[model samples]
Target: MNKHGLFQGGVAVVQPIDRGMTKMLDEQDDLYTVLLEGKLAGKKVQEHEIVESINETIRPYEDYQAYLDLAKNDAIQFIFSNTTEAGIAFDPQDTLTARPQNSYPGKLTALLYERFKLGKKGFQIIPCELINHNGNTLKEIVLKYAKLWDLGQNFVDWINTDNDFYATLVDRIVPGYPKDRATDLERAWGYHDKLIVKAEPFLIFVIEGNKKLEKLLPLKDAGLNVVVTDDMQPYRNRKVSLLNGPHTTMSPIARLAGIDTVGKVMQDKDFYKFINDEMYQEIIPTVALPKKELVAYAEGVKERFENPYVNHELSSIALNSISKFKARLLPTFKRYVATNHKLPQRITLALASYLKIYGGRADFEPQDTPEVLAAFKTLVQNDDYVTAALADAKLWGEDLTQYTGLVTLVKQDLQSLDQGGARQAVQQINQKGD
Candidate 1:
C-alpha cells in the first residue's frame, strides 16, 4: 500500500536499483557490516563488509587509502550524511581498527582516499548533516586527516586539485519509517526490512557545488527540488533566515508561549501573522534574495514543520542554545545590529528566554562558566534583570544590559510566566511579538 493504502496488496517492496547500487551490491561484502558487537551482519560485499546502509559502507572503507577508487569504479557519486555537528569531531589517537577515527570527517577522509586511489576520480559528496558549509567542512576534514596521517603533500595537493564536494541543503523529514504502522507495513512489503525508512513526500536536495554535478545526477529532473548552483549561500541564507532562523528564535518563546509544536503556533491566526510579517517579512528583506523567493521558501518550510511523519519537538530545537544562538540567531542579529545600531528587540527577547531556559532548567550543556551559570540561576528568578546578563559580554559580546527599554519589555514577559514554564513564556512572546 502506497501510504494511502489504496493499492493495498498490489504494492511491492523493491530496492530502487540504479547502476550505482547494483555495482556495490555485486561486491556485497565490499559495502556493509563492520564487526558490530564482534559479529558481522547484513549482505556481504567484496570488501568483506556487509551491505548495510550508505553510512555503514563508508564506515569500513573510511580509513583505507584506496577508498576513493572504489567509489569511482562503482559510479557512486554522492555521500549523504545526517550526522550531528558534534559527529564531525576528531580525536588524536584514533587508529585503524578501534577508533576508526571516530568522526564523520575522519571516516569520510578514509573513504575518499579509497575512491581516489582506485581510479583517481572525484566523488560528488552531498552531506546532509545540517551543518554549516557541509561540503567545505567535509573537504577540510579530509585535508586534516591527510596531514595527521602524514600522507604527504602530494595527496593533499590531489585532494585540493581533484575533489568535488557539494555543500547541500537536504530538507526531507525522514522520520525512519512509521513505527505506529509496523504490522501493516511489514505485511504489505511481504518481508521484514528494518532499513525501510519513512520520509515525507517533500524532499529537497539543494547543492552548492560544482555545476557539473547537476548534469550527472539530474535529481531535479526526477521531480525533486534538487538545485545545483555555485552559490548555495543564497539558498542557505533563505532557509536559515526564513525557516530555521524564525523557528530558532520562536521555539523557546513558543515553548514559553505554551505552544508545543510549530504546527500548533502556526494555526493561531494572529501568531502566524506576527511570524510571517515580523519575522519573515521584516527580517527577510535584510537578506539579499528577492522577496518572492523568500515567500515561497517560507511557505515550504511551514509544510515541512507540519509534516506528521516527524516530531521535531520545540524542546529538541532548544538544544545547545548557546551554539545555536551563535550559528543561527547571531548572524541575523549581527546583520540587524549592523543596520539598527542596537540589539533587535524580538531577538533580544528570544535571547532572554534562552537565558531563562539555562537556569538548570533544560537539558542543554552550559558553557563552563561559574559566573554564567550563576547569572542564569539569578536571572531565572528575576526576568527583568537585564543588568547582569547584558554585562556579561563574554556571552552577548557587547553590553546589551543598557538596552533597558527592550529589557523592561522582556522582563515583563519573563516575569509573567511561571518559573520554568517554557510554554507560557513562549505564548506571551508570540502574542507580544505578533
Candidate 2:
C-alpha cells in the first residue's frame, strides 16, 4: 500500500509493547527503510523509504486498549499479522475483562467481540505465520476463546457468518539488519535508519482464497508473486517437501561433517549431489504439485541455499530435529515407501543421520523437547537403538518400525555413519546408485 499507493485507507500497525521502536516510528512519522539486496536490488529502487508521511496514515500502536479503540472507531477492513507460530494459541487464563489477553487468538477474540457489539462487518484476516493452515488454526483458537469466555451464540454466529480467515504461504528470505555493514549503509543513505531490513530478491505469497479476495487486495497488481487460489495444498506441499525438507534432511548430516553453513554444503560436490538427489528422487516424487513446478521450485531452493549473502547456519536449521523431521521429511518418507513399495535410500540415510545426532553417537548436541532428549538417552543405551527409537510412537507420532524394511535400512545406515562418518557415508551412497 505504501509503495504503490494502492490502498488509500489509513493503516495502523499494532505491535507488542516496545517503547523504543514505537517512539522511533512516531518520531520518524511512520517511515522505515527496506534495503533490497542480492539479484533484485537494482531492478527496482534499491532503498525503499516506505510509508513516508502520506497524511501520516500509518502509525504504530503498542497499547492494546488503544488498538481496540481504533478498531471500534475506524473502519478496519483487514488485519495482517506475523506474530510467530506460537502466537495463535488458546490461553485458558484469558478473560473478557483482561486489559490485553496473552495469546494472539485471545487478543483477536476481544477485538472481534468489540466489533460484534457494534454490528460491524468482519475484517479480512490474513496471518503470515509459518504454520500449516495458519488462518484456520487462528480462527479455531479464537472460537475456543469465545466459548471459554461464555460469549453468546449470536456472537459466534456473527463470527462464522462475517469473518474471512485466509490461510497463506509466504516464502521470502529476510536476513534482517545488515549489522556488519550498517555504518556504510547509513552513510550511503545519508540518514540513520534503526529499523532497516535486508531481504533477498525472491518472494512468493500464496493465499488460500478466491478471485474475489484477490481483487480486494491487489498484491498481484503491485507486481508481486502473489497467488490467490481456492486450494493452496499443492503450493504448501511444494514448499514443505522441497524447500524445508532439504533443510531438515541435510542440516544434521552437513553439521556432522563439520560444515557450518548451507552455502558451504552447496560448495562441496558430494554434499550438493546428496541434497539434489534427495529432492529429485525422494522428496519431489512425493509432493502433490506438478513435476515441472516442483522441479522449478527445487532449483530455486538450490539457488537460495547457495546464496553467499545469506549465511544460513546448519545448527540453526538443526534446531528441534525430531519434530522438524516429522513435519518436513517423514511425510515424504512414508509416501515414497507406499508408492515405491521400497525404501528411499537418501531419506533413509537422512533419518539415520537424525538418529545418530540425537542418539548420542555424534559430537553434536541435539536440541529438542526435554522428554525427547531424555527418551533418546535411554534408547541409545540399547544395542538396537535404531529399532528402539523407531518403535517409540511418542517420538514420531507413530511406530515407524512397522514400515517394511525401514528399521533394517536405517540401522545399516546408522552403522555406516558411526563407522565411516557422514561425508564418507554420503560419498558411498552417491557412488551406489539407487
Candidate 3:
C-alpha cells in the first residue's frame, strides 16, 4: 500500500506488528526502511514510476505496552498484517495477560481486549495472509482465544459488533531484498540501502467487505488496483484457477522435463504452449466468472509467469502437490467433467504427470501426506497402477474412473512415460490432443 500514495495523505499510519519467524522478520525490522525499485517488466511503460522510496518503523514484539498505550490514545484505527500462511493459527496455550501472545491472532486478541477495556471503537483489521478467508479465519481464531481466556462476554460482544475484519486477496511478486541486483541498483540510485524491495508493477488487493471499508480506505483514490466487493468468490476463483492452478498443474510437468524456475519453463516453447492452451482452453471455460474477465486474468497470469524479476522454482511450487491438486484443480476438473461430459485432455495429462511424480519412482521424492505416499506406493506395486489409482477415491475427492476413457487415457500416458520418459510422454500426449 505504501507503493501507492496512500500513506502520503496522512489518512493512516503504517504500523508494523511482529508475528514471529525470526529470520525474515528480523530483516524487515532491522531495516525499518524500504526502497521500492523495480521496472514494470511487461508491455507497460518502462519510464513510469509506480513505487517510490518509503520508510517506516517496525515496533518490536517486546513493545506490547506501547501498543496498549496506542490503543488507549486511539492512535490506531486499522490493523494490517502479513503473517504468512501459518500465522493465523489458534494456540490454546495463549492467554490475555502475557506481554504479547505468541500467535498472531492471540496477539490481536490481547490488543483488542486492551482497546475494549479503554472503551475505544473498533479497528478495521485486514490480514494479508495467503490463506483463504484470511480475515474471517483471523477473527475466528481471535474469538476462540477470547473464549479460551474467559475475557468476558462484553469483550466478545464488542468484538463481534464493533470490529470490521475484511477478507483480502493481495497479489504482488515482491522478491524481497534483491541481493543479486542490489549493487547495480545501489550504483544506479546513488545510494546504499539494504532494504530494497523488487516488485512487479502488477498489483491487486481484492477486499471483501461492505461500503464502510470502501469509504475508509482511500486506496482507489491513490490510483491503486484495489477492488472492494460484497462477494470475493469470483476474484478468489480467478486467482485459484489462473495463478495457483497453473503452478500446481505445471510443477510436475516442468520438474519432470528438467526445468527449474517458472520463468525458465515459460521460456520453453512447448511447455509455454502447453500451459497457455491449458489455461485458455480448459481452465478458463470451466471458471464460473465471465469469459472476458477470466481471459484478461489469464493473460495477466501469463505475464506474471514470464516476469524476469521473479525466479519461482518448480520445487517450491511442487510442495504438497497432493492437497494443492485437490484444493486448486479438482473443482475445475469436476466442472469440466460436468459441462463437457468428458475428462479434460490437458487436466488429465497434468493429473498423469502428478501421479507419475509421486509414484516413488521419480528422481526426487515428492512431499505429501504419509498416507497418500503409502497409497501411491501401493498403487505402483499393483498390476495396473493407473486403473487402480484412478479408481481410488481416497486420493482424488471422487472416483476419476467414473469418467469414460479417463482411466484408459491416464494409463496410456503413464505407459508412454514408462517407455520414453517425460519428454516423450509430453510430446506424445500433446500429439494425441492435436
Candidate 4:
C-alpha cells in the first residue's frame, strides 16, 4: 500500500502494548515515518518528499482513550497490521476496561467493543501474518476473548455480522534499516531518515475473499500484484511444499555433505539432482493442484535456491530440523507411501541424512529438543540406531517400524553415509532412484 499512492489517505500505527518491540518504535519516534524506495522503473515508481511518505500518528498504548474517541467518531475505516506471525494469539488476562489488552486480538476486541457501544460502523481488519488461515484465526481468537470477557451476546453478534477479517498472504523481502549502506544512502538521499526500509522488487498480497473484497480493495487498479481468491489454500500449499520443503529437507543432507550454502549445494551436480528429484518426483506428485502449476512453482523454487545474490546457509536452515521435517516433508512422505505402497526414496534418504546431521558430526550443532538431541547422541553410537529412532513414536509421531523395508533402506543409507561421505550416500540414493 505504501508503494502505491493508496496510503495518501493516511495510516495509523497503534502499538500493541505487549509486542515487546515497542521500544524500537518509540525510541526517538518522529512522525511514524518510513521511506519506501520503489524497485520498479515505470509509472509505479514516483518521487515523493520524505515527509509525505508514511506519516502516521504513532499512538502509544496509554492513549487508548484517544483511539477510543476516534473509534466513537468513526474516524478510522481500515485496520491493517503486520504484527508478525505470533501476534494473533489469545490472552485470557486481557480485559475490555483495563486500559488495553496485551494480545493483538485482545486489543482489537476492546476497540471493537468501544465501537459497538457507540453503534459505529464496522472496519475492515487485515492481518499480514504468515500463518495459515490468519484472518479466520484472528477472528477465532477475538471471539474467544470476547466470550472470555463475558462481553454479552450483542457484541458477539456485532462481531460476527459487522466486521471483516481478511486472511492475507503477504510476500516481500523487506530487510529493514539497511545499516551497512546507511551512510551512503543518507548522503545520496540528503536526509538522515532512520525509518528507511530496503525491500526487494517482488511483492504479493493474496487476500482470501469474495467479490465484495475485490470491489472494496481494487488494489489491482493501481498495478499492484494483489490477488483476491476464494481459496488461498492452493497458493499456501504451493509455497510451503515447493519452497520451504526443499529448504528443510535439503539443509541436513547438504550440510552433512560438507556443503555450506544453498547456492553451493546447487553447484554440485549430484546434490542438485537429488534436490530436483525431491521436488519433482516426491513433493510435486503429492500436490493436488494442477501439475503444470506445481511444476512451474517448483522450477521457481529451484531458481530461488540457486540465486547467487542470496547466501542461504544450510546451517541456519538446519535449525530445529526435527520440527521442520515434521511440517515440511513428513506429509508428503506419508502421502507418497499411502499412494505407491513404497517409501519416497529421496525423503527417506533425506531423513537418514537428518539423523546423521543431528548425530553431531556436522560443523554446526543440532538445535532441537533435549530429548531429540539426547536420543540421537546415544543412538548414533548404536548399531540399531535406524530402528531405534524410527520406532521412537515421540520423534516421528508414528511408529515408523510398521512400514515394511523402510528400516533396512534407511539403515543401508546410513551405512553408506558412514562408510563414504554425503556425495557417496547421495550417489547410492540416486542410483536407487534411477
Highest lDDT among the candidates is held by which one? 2
> On residues 1-434, what C-alpha lDDT tens digit does candidate 4 reach at each position?
44575543555567664333445544535332333444343223323244343334445465677666657645576788876544666666778777766677887888888889888888888888666788999999988987898989999899888898888876554445555666876798676666655444456778886558765666887787889988888877777678777787778777777787777988999988888888888888888999999997687667656654445567666656776676667878888888788888878878888877777655668876555688788777778777888887866778889988999988877877778977888877777783
Poorly placed runs, candidate 2 (over 4 Å): 9-31, 40-70, 83-102, 315-324, 348-401, 405-420
C-alpha root-mean-square deviation, each candidate: 10.8, 4.7, 5.6, 6.1
Model 1 poorest ten-residue lDDT run = 10-19
Q: In candidate 1, which residue ranges exceed 4 Å CA deviation?
A: 1-77, 89-98, 113-122, 175-196, 256-259, 268-274, 303-312, 315-324, 355-359, 363-420, 427-434
RMSD of 4: 6.1
Against the reference, the lDDT scores of all candidates come to: 0.58, 0.79, 0.74, 0.73
Pairs in clash, predicted candidate 4: none
Residue 273 lDDT in candidate 4: 89
lDDT of 3 by residue, 125-225 (tens): 99987667888989999889888999999998999899999898877665555667679866876656655655566778899987777667788877878
User: RMSD in Å for candidate 3, one decimal?
Assistant: 5.6
Question: Which pairs clash in the backbone of model 2?
Answer: none
TM-score winner among the candidates? Answer: 2
lDDT of 3: 0.74
Segments of candidate 3 deviating more than 4 angstroms: 1-73, 84-103, 175-179, 191-195, 315-327, 348-421
